[model samples]
Target chain A: MHELTTTRNNYQIDPVLTVWGWEIPVYLFLGGMVAGMMIISGYFLFKGRQKEPTCSCFYVPWVSLILLSLGMFSLFLDLSHKVYVWRLYTTFKIASPMSWGAWILILVYPVIIANIFIRLPKFVTDKFPGLEKYSKMLTDRPRLIQNIGVANMILGALLGMYTGVLLSSLGARPLWNTSILWLLFLVSGLSGAAAFVHMVAKNIYERELLAKADNGFLTFEIFVIGLMFIGLATSTEVHQEAAQMLLSGSFAPVFWVFVVGIGIIIPLIIQLFAVNHKIQHTPVAPIMVIAGGLILRFVIVNAGQVSHYLNAHF
Target chain B: MARFAMVIDTKKCVGCMDCVVACKTENNVPEGYNRDWITQEAFGNFPNIQLEIRSERCNHCENSPCVSSCPTGASHYHDIGGVVLVNHDECIGCKACVASCPYDARFIHPDGYADKCTFCIHRVEKGDKPACVSVCPTNCMYFGDLEDPNSDVSKLLKSRKWHTLHPEAGTNPHVFYLT
Candidate 1:
């Protein structure tokens, strides 16, 4: 009997793709974090919370803008042909997730910049009086700020969902083929953002309110994750094997210990109690939620790449 | 329009690396990499075992995921034979094509572009067979337009019981292997 011994076959990295690395996960985490910030801050802005002295809605657009650019930078670094990156925008293939992401990110900048000018610091406007027109235009029209808020909400959801869609579109990678993956990533972003708002907001009332919201998001995020795994587990044998990697394979350790256990459940329980006033709020739980979001991205991207069609017994 | 496809006879294949070597030399494929490879599989236990060998590369599927997933339109079907080809100048090397390929046939070249079997279109255009089909000592390979009823590949596929890899993928791959 001839042994095909493909274990020695090392072509194009490996039979399993390692084409993507830390760059992808880092970009996804930052992109999701910023996407969450946009929605949370936009909701408050739409509600006119910007009028409050210490409302997070006023400054987070600025932070979101910075984080999103950094996320794009990491994505840029992943491109093997950096100079041809402009070609992505030259044509819009409606079916391609990367095309959708490229256009969405471009649109995000203008919306975020306009949002920042809504409550421009007086000193900066005073220094650059010519730039004051933006503040005048939006501040003069209360409806436009609300419209900006609406735009942010829609775009934020698209950005968050697209992060997962990027991976999900590759049906060859069985682990990421579920439609619910987009919703899972979006809900995770929302939960992480709520935790951030709860931890950073200066107003005690707003902090308490955001902590409650974080718990709701966390609960929902857990449900969505369950739906994703169930969808995978019930899929074709190829997909079932892919799901097994995270469920019981080598990835089980990280997926269970870091992502489900410490990253989600423990922080979720702590935040629930803190919101209920049973425990004083410490930075620990919120920090864990944020770090958990990061770890989740790493696990998903890495495990998804390792999962392939060949492992299926036909 | 001519639709190019390749047909290989697995029963006669000796698990030789000739096709892999010829492709590297003809395409100037980077060192330590190849566009084609040999796969040998055996079924049942030692005494009653049966072996199957295949020389494989890009299937150039009619419904190719690489072309559809490409954000830049860099991976496209050549108008000549609907053969899949990548434009190095336009490819951003995002690896979306690499990841989406069900067969894992494409790879990123060291020069930072998606690379795969072209079925040796350069030679086919010059009225010569693919480097692999030409170099095979056993004459186990055939290449021609499958659309033409009179072509060698078309006739061979018609007469012999053949199978394509990953039929479940629904890619409608052009490459076929005769049992």
Candidate 2:
């Protein structure tokens, strides 16, 4: 009899690569959610709804600022050298998606900050009497507000797509190498944003409209996921094996249960019924969608790391 | 103008891991980490099986993904022989290069920089071989300018059939193995 042996150093590469921890997924989820918020706020502003009392444009921009900061913080924590993060801004590598993201984030601050002034709350103006002039300056110029809307939408889409492209560009990881991943992330972000606005907007019309939009985006999200799997299944054998991780492998349960069932399908069904007025609209559906979006990020990031180019051990 | 390349004669390798230890000692690599290692692969039925042992490290590929993916230009080609190296001060410890490498040749240094084999660029500038190639006792490794047809590494490739680690990756890896 003969024995065969293999060694995979733990401190080195192993059954799989696990360089990213919870931080990446948390950052990805928050970034995507913020992307969705920007698009929703931009769309509302373009329609000249900033004057309306229930318009979420006023709240979303400010909220997005805080949420994005949190997300960026998580991303910063993931860095091996946190102090040198400033180095990312020094030069732009056209081949690097992370560079695009850093620059996009820089643009996000000014645009979202400008949006907050379009409908600066009276309480804030009252506290800082000197700020009234800038608020009036922005609110008086509808055309300027509309331009910021276009900028937000454009930047929003870029931010959303950048999250997915970030993963897809690393062709070394078989699970993230699909062409459809960008669209999937963008749609998921849009869906999450729609659900959030539907939950928070006080106007009956706005809530109903956002509910309808949320349903549409969720349905599109399901389709995009199907296409992503189809693309993966048809790729090389290694890619197909990589897809197996999310399908029937160890990650299958979380993928099918938390992400697909509770996170997506149930919320999707609830929103569909609420949009149709077959059931009363509740916050449950939107919350589910948000949570599902987060879980999806976790599952994909973890599974992608486990899906090796040379071996499908996990 | 020297495109430095490495040629490993697998049949001559003993998988002693002298190369891994030498890299640690020479580079002062962090504890529980190394810049190179040995791999043993076997094929065929038990009695007729063929065992191939390889001492592997960073390929320092021509189309290096790690360099291209680095947002801060920390991972760049050195002047001596286009050897890939990470400037410790410039690296942000993002690990994007680590993920981009198909060979999994990198790890995060305890000091927060992406760490990997540099082909001993520091020593090479002084006209010394890489730690691994220099310490290899079995004489299974060779390093020289592949662009120079007269070089020993290039001559070995011309005389013997060789294969790279992941040609389909399109990395244009500079390392080759003689089976």
Candidate 3:
């Protein structure tokens, strides 16, 4: 070229933009997984699958409370002004994902409690006979129980979508800017829930049923993730660079190897073989699915931070 | 209503980082954190390189993502001059704004709130310039009400060929750089 004169701004500052840490990703992962668990249990209740001894609907609510509480605790630790967190509930912001999530969580507690009450296990009734009346009333009213199941499904869907929307609405990170992120999160959440059920179910039929469900959800999750990447890549240069961060840049190895390879692909293949009876089912694949789900959130959250507009050399 | 804005002349910038120091001292930024910073772009090969030193900070965008991302309305646009400011008491340190800021301008102060360049609101409220603008040795920084056509920043924008940090992001940042 004729007298090459290139202009670039290479001076960089450390710790300039970074703020979030491990807490956020952990919160997101747990929240999505819990939402998935709620949906699975709700669907089972709606379908009257409670007759099965190993029905996930029996214990998912109780387990969800513990998991969600842990997630919330992690979130609480991230807040600088933990005492002022009540301010978030003082007002409802239609535009804020955090506000919506707060209200959804408030509603989720009652639904979860009702779910557990309606499907109280024998150990609980045996130990505390006094609580039998409430359980009896819930069990007696089939229509009312089904209605609660529907409510759980609706609320669970909202919670699942809200987790991803929380990050995507920020619009600052191109990797999170894609509209399909919420869908990917929802599908992944459902897959994790299915895998969780597959691992814990005592009934072989129920276990196989959940394993098959997990296979379907995992496939759908992969498709949604592909869409998310495509959506980002086809957008502006900044978004394209953001996609590259996951594709072949610094985050590629972890994303492809850990998240995609070890987390998803291997599990999907193994599960398919297990379902076809070509191989005996092991908890390894379902466990991998859960681990993959968690890693997916970590990769997305951290990679989004690395993908910035200014850092990209246009 | 006035719209506050800052314009930096890259040609005049020495990247001495006086602005960064002044901002930290004036704002009492926590240790290991900053409210403003500088970025240098050097291009070309060998001795024939073209270098551009940019003193950067929060763009204080007209369409601020931080404002919308904040659930408690802690990060808000000041009606007086369109300055993006965070109310520390109301902020829960959720870091939503920190993650959403395309400019990477915000940080979680040790005090447990999101903070960024406020354009020295305390000084500006007293009819004074921002600390960084007032302390620039090369006079490369200009801060004024863009709403006032006669203001220094407005005049500079009109007279100079300027570019914002990320026009593609569509945040409509108030900070402009004159090449």
Candidate 4:
């Protein structure tokens, strides 16, 4: 016979850091990626580059709908009262970022559909005679098509910035309470989208153009990230600690290895070399960019939760 | 037109966690989650150390980020005393309020909506004290309408030296701690 005993692990409960989880960062990643794709697609359409098979305008809207739906599904999974999700549209609270996001998404669907219509491939339009009439309406009015491109660009930019503004407005998490977060997220989205297009581009000229654009966006992203750190470090003590979470604390490894090293710098260096013909273009760089972009959101969301006003140290 | 608040006397607190237990029992707080809890902090070095015990919960802020961040008006102020309450029926469980709260007072209830201390409004409405206040062995917790000068909380504020958690966060918390 043996005496039975129970053992317990003595982990302190962090009361202030319990509300959010993994679903948030995944949703942010998907939302940002969709915004990026739309912007790329919009720009190509605005420039009247629909003839190229590799032009994002041809397939971006279809792809965007699928990606956005996936992102919304992730968000829906996070909700506790899934049946009550319809209540979000009952009325808009102007102060609420969540409200703005809901409305923006509603607006996004139609714009994406119109964009897809604008760039409808001939084979499909020929198959459906009714679709050709609508496609012709877009082709007949160059200004209408241009206005649609502008609308997508504006909507896409707003969607990208909203993802960051959503976090920054929290004010509770020092890591997220920065004005620079929106710019960083938007630029990251653009770069991510550019990398995605670069990978799938069938035309050499389009691929090269996107590669160059991604490189530019990457450089700007580095600057925005640096500015964010500087802004945080210069603020109150708690804000400094929040910034340190990325600079030297628990999140440092992820931020440096995944976000900065593999995500930004490696891809940047590869693209630079490829541009000079020192190396051939490979999917490796673009894939790394996409991975880094996703990791950036994860790091921000997770690390932001860990950063708070009062804890054991206080 | 009442503005309710809680004043906790840290000196009288024994860290026995009775208030925590009482709150859970009264509120039916889910397993592995808490509506209120205790936090212990040790200040100074080795021999000169001062140990502090705090009973922490939602401040029900006058400038609550959670309220403004809520998309569907699920998190709103009650009409009677400006108490922040959640309409679970309207909650989409987006967790915007959870992230926006600086004190980290709110949690996603297992039922899938944002939940937190209601200051025991159900009891307060019935002219009863909150469970934590009624059960505190050390008599450390004080609750009343801050707008009423006759209320015990207002008198205590007038007599004691008190501070709020994270004043710099600027939510202007209704909860106060007397050193």
Give the candidate order by descending DockQ.
1, 2, 4, 3
TM-score of chain B of 2: 0.97
lDDT of 4 by residue, B1-179 (tens): 79999999999998788888898899998777777888766667667777667888899999999999999999999997899999988988888898788776777777778889999999999999989999999999999999999999999999999999888888899999988
- Residues A67-115, candidate 4: write the lDDT tens digits: 8899888888877788999998899999998899989988988988999
Per-residue lDDT over A209-263 for candidate 3, one digit per residue giving the tens place of the 0 to 100 score: 8889998998888788788888888888879998998888988998898888887
Candidate 3 clash pair list = A8-B41, A8-B42, A9-B40, A9-B41, A10-B40, A10-B41, A11-B40
- Enumerate the candidates' DockQ scores in order: 0.60, 0.58, 0.44, 0.48
Tell me the tens digit of each residue's lDDT in model 1 across B1-179.
89999999998888687888999899999877768888877777778898888898999999998988899999999988999999999999899999898888888888888999999999988999999999998889999999999999999999999999878877899999999
The number of clashing residue pairs in each candidate reads: 0, 0, 7, 1
**Model 1, residue B109: C-alpha shift (Å):** 1.0
User: Which consecutive 10 residues in model 3 chain A have the weakest lDDT in total?
Assistant: A1-10
| Residue A259, model 4: Cα distance from true site in angstroms | 1.1
Off by over 4 Å in 2: A1-12, A312-314
Model 3 interface CAPRI class: acceptable
> Which of 2 and 4 is the better model by lDDT?
2
Worst ten in a row by lDDT for model 2 chain A: A1-10
Candidate 1 lDDT at A12 equals 47
TM-scores, in order shown? 0.97, 0.97, 0.92, 0.93
| Full-model lDDT, candidate 1 | 0.87
| Models ranked on lDDT | 2, 1, 4, 3
Query: lDDT for model 4, on a 0 to 1 scale?
Result: 0.86
- The window of 10 residues in a row where model 1 chain B has the poorest summed lDDT is B38-47
